[model samples]
Target chain A: MTASSSLDGVLAPVLTPFGPDLSVDEARFIRLARTLMDQGLGLAPFGTTSEGNSLSVDEKIGLMDALAAAGLDMARMMPGTGCCALSDSVRLSAHAVTLGCGGVLMLPPFYYKNPSEDGLFAAFAETIERVGDARLRVFLYHFPQQSQVPITLSLIERLLKAYPGIVAGAKDSSGDFANMEAMCTHFPGFKVFAGTERLILSVMRAGGAGCISANANIHGAAMLDLVRRWQEPDAAKHQTALEGFRSVMEGLPLIAALKAVTARRTGEPEWRRVRPPLVQFPVEREEELMERLKGIGVLG
Target chain B: MTASSSLDGVLAPVLTPFGPDLSVDEARFIRLARTLMDQGLGLAPFGTTSEGNSLSVDEKIGLMDALAAAGLDMARMMPGTGCCALSDSVRLSAHAVTLGCGGVLMLPPFYYKNPSEDGLFAAFAETIERVGDARLRVFLYHFPQQSQVPITLSLIERLLKAYPGIVAGAKDSSGDFANMEAMCTHFPGFKVFAGTERLILSVMRAGGAGCISANANIHGAAMLDLVRRWQEPDAAKHQTALEGFRSVMEGLPLIAALKAVTARRTGEPEWRRVRPPLVQFPVEREEELMERLKGIGVLG
Candidate 1:
């Protein structure tokens, strides 16, 4: 399940489970992974929604090991391996590749502002060169809205021409359809996954691989179905439903709302405890979100 | 020395020295500290100009320990100890207090966006609570122009009221003289250090302690002279030279230019190496910067 091979399906940025004491609840995390796998979705843990940046390298590696022990197929997963430091990103990305994970979603070392494209090329090339593993396939994560650094089409061209095999594809979370269209048009065989569910149909229409969305944690099956039937007779109906769910998530601090929905569904109260600076939703926001979820038929 | 006992002075955000391999150059770094001390300047390392967020905790702690080992007076220096992670901030800041450093210049946990005032309060208060040291005197760092997170006036008041002694002053890098004046007026006794040299006179006029500027590396004596004669009839003459130097550094990457100057001055050409993603200035830019410096009489 290397990225050079195909990942022609939906993938969820899985919800991280915290136990009562707020430690990584590995078993529950594994359980969630299994649930997504059972629903025919691929896994992407340790992404932005997975609180990837907050976890130390050791914690991230431990979680991956636990997932492997749980017998989840690594080839179907694309763990996020990005950090402010190049070496940290390299360690996580290279290790994930060695573990037989499908591909690494690498975010640019993002602390600096307006890093030149040449700087970006150097960072990416150095990581690939240092990892020095032919088995590794790197998928650039282009969430410029958060990273403050974007993966431009020109950069993609430069990387592709330099090392065609090492740089496989990208995730365009810029929420710009035109940018996604450009990637899909220019890099024909490269796998382009939408960063959100809202763009699934457009991405698919433009010949993208399926979406790797955060909301997949709650509406996994529906979004998966939306991707599946987007070319079907009743495509519009499912697309509208998917868009509605995306709207709710967009309206709030998305990660918190996703955790809230997960908590409500699983009755896992500890799921609601986010790290400080990202507080749990206050009672009113939580209640409103719960009602929205129930109204959308996501929760009964 | 506790911040409350003696916190008013001009502190230089000391430049970090990098070896040819871009690893921490301890000897040069310590030498820079000694040089600043000899010239009647207090020391602060690991500010934005020092590329603190770009450093590993080990690098930060190692540098601080080296400074202490060199028998430099910690009472005259405030090493930056803030970071995106609360735990990391605590470890570095607490250790600074334990080592008897003057005070910790603490930046807000900045990776997240628009953190609530309560969250900011918790992040600050919790660090103090965890360190739980009576000797800790925190100098809040407000550099919104860089950190993308501003410390508002109300928040400052709240933190001051909560921990009267633990929170001492602030370093305002907003580059807004009006804001500095407001801060000085609001917090009567709080020592405010202008983040930029351009604002030094206005800041001093508004009762600011002094500046913690990156340009101070090149114009340390002239800037210090301005600080000294802030009330003298000929003070403006020295400040004009400082301004001319500042304009050149502003036109280039100040940190890189400063390093290049140090490298050439100390005969450590290898110190010109910057970490990846921040390559050394192109030869033309370097040449131009050198010419600019020579014209201003800082270089020959």
Candidate 2:
């Protein structure tokens, strides 16, 4: 149950930037990863916030080199490698492992809904077996709201029993804090993560790893600050302040809103552009969003 | 708007054949497709039944050439080309178009669930625009049960109005006959389809073009026979026979059941192998399945 892992920290699923042609802006991606690392945050690139599902396998692979070139250690980066296809997952994970990534956050094959646990287990097992690199580590992504293929506790238990070390942990984004708490308690050594910073204090108290949040793209330093000092008495107050962002994000298109704020912060309009099936945050709301962020001291 | 399309008939979302190693067996796939076509079925080679999501984009692209090489006219095929990534979807659709395929059946981006109509519309519009092919025709695949993103009427109307000749039709796999009937009634000359043969008679009666069914893999001739003769007096009797397959498929793992029967019929055990996330049909259930099929006269 040693917490001697590079992955056990506050990580941001880096928001992807796209050029005018809606292509992956590798330079921007690397720059963001570097900036987050400089702020003492680990990086979980290519998770939902990055619109990982919106990028092709080649595009995802193409952006990895820039991270290395930017002097960002692969050891602190956990790129999301899950695709609907087993072969695609294997290739992406194998590539990540080769580059010394801390771990690959994996989503179940989400296209098929309500698959049996045995079927899901087989999917995870096959990917792990095919990747074949002993260096490979996996975090089962449990965002039931987005990915209807839920990674239930029994499924986790099965994976843990089968491949103890390789099945490292999970990211619970069901917005169900109880599930996150249960995961942290049940899997003693596993690195469980909350999808938002609001649960960081509670998750940490439960012996969980840390937060891998969408908001961390904009508030990396703040989240990392709390992560490092959550044992203090004022941790709840810190969490409450952080919880303000979620209220701002509520009822708005979340990923789009995050991108909008990133665009404002970085002075790069391209940060606001999302891939198709994800419209940009409305221009009309930007003023209100910024005002609210400033109200909570989330923006200066 | 003339019903002269090769795609306007019974098309099997052709069952994929996997080898012992679990890689797509191109030769077996071509052989099965050829057999189905020979039995008077059009081909939708990469739909849900085909384990389309279980395949990588390259793997899907690699299989297309074999369909062309088998003396199978691509104009008689409408391959499923949707992916979670817009680029991947565009690439797949464009590839299908270039090969002279009649149409591409497209699932909306299935990864991010509950995307807005605007976002979904933008995804479709973007894929169509980026593909930039005039000859391309698309069948908006509405399989909400698996994809979780339902293609509502308003979304369909938007797509249709925007792309007159291009947004040719839809395949309603909701198993809700009312929706299919409504599509047929609401949009004149739009080709609506049922996802199974049991609904074929009803769909065609309501002006649906035909069916793109999974059972067509095992029972192509029987369904196609019913499709051709549904206008005849004894059509109900023919449909009753076809409906028997659904009863057997009920409460069983569908794709696996289809594959097991295909294996038995072809005398190729390899047909039973599915990619990971979908285990082979339970060996124990094979006998009962076979017995039931026999009872229904689905087996010789």
Best by lDDT: 2
lDDT string for model 2 (A2-71, tens) is: 3338987789999999999898999888888888888889999889988999999999888876787677
Task: Please provide, for model 1 over B1-300, each residue's C-alpha lDDT reduced to its tens digit, 9 standing for 90 to 100.
Answer: 124635455677887767644568899889888987787778879887777766667788899999999999898888898776555677898999988998899998776768788878877887788788998889999988677778999999998898887888889988888989998999877878888888778788888888888776656666677877899887777777778778777767667777787776778776576655666666566666777788979866
- Name the lDDT of candidate 1: 0.80
* Residue A72 error, candidate 1, Å: 2.7
Q: Which lDDT value does model 2 have at A26?
A: 90
Cα shift from native, residue A217, model 2 (Å): 0.7
- TM-score quality measure for candidate 2: 0.98
Q: Which candidate number would show the highest DockQ if scored against the true structure?
A: 2
Q: Candidate 2, after superposition: displacement of residue A77 in Å?
A: 0.4
Worst 10 residues of 2 chain B by lDDT: B1-10
CAPRI tier of model 2: high
TM-scores of all models?
A: 0.92, 0.98
Give the lDDT of residue A132 in candidate 1. 87
Chain A TM-scores of all predicted models: 0.95, 0.97
